[model samples]
Target: MNYTLDFGPVVAGLPDLLRGCAGTLFLAVVGMAIALVIGVVGVVLRESPVRPLRWAVIAFVELIRNTPFLVQIYFVFFALPLIGIRLAPTPTAIIALGLNGGAYAIEIIRGGVQSIHKGQVEAGFALGLHKRDVFRFVVLRPALRAVYPSLTGQFVMLTLTTSIASAIAAYELTSVAKLIENESFRSFEVYGTITVLYFLMSWLMMRAFGLVSRRYFSYPVR
Candidate 1:
């Protein structure tokens, strides 16, 4: 068996790839912001004096994290119409990814929060600071800082997961690759190009996150 791979169509579709990348980045940013907010809310609820609220948040996180993201996305895109609710592809994609990512972030953030020493909070209370101020000035900053690397790693993973958006015709990078493959009949070459692009994009994200950690975290080098 012999196969000839043509790279021309993939090269010609560079503009489409750029557009998809922009959309992918936009979705990732929006989704990560949503995920962060959800994580914080979940953490606060988990720590609430109200026991029932904490358990409810825990159950929500467990349900989302244990389920498949594809099913979640399909439900968001398809099930809503039956209830007379509509969401544009972008929001649906963002919400699905955000909710899924947020579930995982809850655990990650909880671990960071748990790692904090009691002295930090005790000291804040010792100074007569309010509960909100103690968490804001002490717990929040340290916890987020401790988990910064994991957060960025999760964001990169979500960026890759954005490829699933193509399934619902969201026109992401994989969708562009599909178009090129259909036109040129070169699945190997087209998909190979996609692999390289994904690698480059993820590598860039890793570097950027590393830089951010260096600037914001500044842990002892020793």
Candidate 2:
């Protein structure tokens, strides 16, 4: 069978495509923001003076990290309605991404924090620095710097995972591509172009984040 690839349908949909991109970006940005906040909370709880709280944090991390994101999203989107909670598709996608990403990042950040030398903490104390100042100045910055690259990489991965949002009717880039493909009946060309766009966007975001890392975190160029 000879297949003729037509760009007309996809090309004509560029305006709507851009709008879909914006929706994806919005969800991703919100999700990442929530994730970062949760990550910090996770770290704090894990290090808590309260033993039960610490264990709870560990359990939360393990559960979220080990499970498939699709299952989690379905629980929120479909099952939650039974419990009288129904999130809009965009909100659900953003929340799920944030919660999932944060769970993974907690370990990464925790590893970075724990990797800091014990001697450094003692030295800060010997210098008469308050606990807050010591943690903020001595430990936190170094830990974040250590895991900067991993965090950036995760965000890039999240770009592709936004397709899951499409499954829940979030109307992200991939979802839009699906819509276009269905209407235009050009799965090969539509998907081929979508793949190209995904790669391009991921690479560009990675490069941009790399620059930000170098500028803000002082991560060594290697």
Candidate whose TM-score is highest: 1
TM-score for each prediction?
A: 0.95, 0.94
Distance from true location, Cα of 168 in model 1, Å: 0.6
List model 1 lDDT by residue over 79-189, tens digit each: 998999888888899999999889888888888999889998999999999999998878988999999989889989999999998878776788888888888898888
List model 2 lDDT by residue over 137-197, tens digit each. Answer: 8898899899889887887787778888888888788889889988999888778877887
In the order shown, the candidates' Cα RMSDs to the true structure are: 1.5, 2.0
TM-score of model number 2? 0.94
Pairs with backbone N, CA or C atoms under 3 Å apart (clashes), candidate 2 = none
Tell me the lDDT of model 1 at 163: 91
lDDT of 1 at 149: 85
Which stretches in model 1 have alpha-carbon errors above 4 Å?
A: 220-222
Off by over 4 Å in 2: 219-222
